[model samples]
Target: MAGFLELIDNTLGTHFHTPVYDPQTGRKKILRVIELASKQHNEGTTRAPNRSWAAGNNEGISFSPKIDGKPVLIGGKETNFVHKSRFQDFLKGLKAAVEKGDLDKEIKAALDGDAAPRASTSSSSGTRSGRNPLSNVRSSIGRSLGNGKSLEEAEATARANPKFDAAHIDQVVAEAKANAK
Candidate 1:
């Protein structure tokens, strides 16, 4: 069982870039599994980070467990497989199961628990709401700087233009340099 858990952990770790087991207990951690699932959910779609591995869908991953001589499909809400808040409890339960050699029962219980909360759609909504307010300022400044203008031209313009403040620029530069280290 420990070997099986280690195999799963290594397989998952390669794909997810995160640890997937409780080292002390030699068990697969449920929270880590949930995190991997979440990453799979968000990787690859129109999502900015584009990490959805199984298409653009957010449907929770499925697991099959043999409990009491019956094979059960653990998915949807009963799995609570994607809920972030329940991660710690899930990990604890899984560790306990591994220690007792009843992984099958623990897996079944997780799969049969209350449905996890639906994944949020805020990323899509935020992207569509409009460009960030700061973006407008950046664009305006970029335009004012003009295409292919030399640094000398910019400096000359700043010196000749009343609106350009060299003192403010120096202060900003100084502050940024101070904070860089």
Candidate 2:
């Protein structure tokens, strides 16, 4: 529904100005907006996020209709609405907000029971965590090999090789040193 989509955009545009914890609040807000939009548009349907869709994905929000065996109308056309990726972009923006700590004030406000509106602004930064030790080793190997393969590929290759285990390599090196002595 165009109204639902517009509500999503407006809510995101507003709520995204301030940060919220868990990203689920943003999701819930989006759902509430969709519900209001459905009411405004005279549709007898409810939209809520699908949890099963988030099993392995890093980001994105998937919403399903509450009413069963009914087609959702968009632009005066009836259609089978399976799932909608509603808050994917909004989640990305919220992630950026979290990383910049812009969300701390907003989260505190929410926890403090204040329902003030949010304000939009630019200029934010984020920091990424360091790589794992094994992944770092894999990256080093890949770099030395002069190939464009990723660290995961190098790690997989090393893991599949029979003689590539740490203890095995140490044993082999010790045996060679003893033989030379």
Question: Which one wins on lDDT?
Answer: 1
TM-score of model number 1: 0.19
- Local distance difference test scores for all models: 0.39, 0.39
Model 1 lDDT tens row, 1-181: 5677555545545658644434333224443443444444445322323221122134433222232322332332232243434434544564455556555444544444312232433443212125542333333334445554544443444445443345643443344345547
Clashing pairs in 2: none
lDDT of 2 by residue, 46-143 (tens): 23233212211443323322112222222222222222333444434444554555544444444444423223221121111233334434444545
Model 1 / residue 53 / CA error / Å: 11
Error of 2 at 1 (Å): 78
Instruction: Tell me model 1's lDDT, rounded to 2 decimals.
Output: 0.39
| Model 2 worst lDDT run, 10 consecutive residues | 120-129
How much is the lDDT of residue 163 in candidate 2? 30
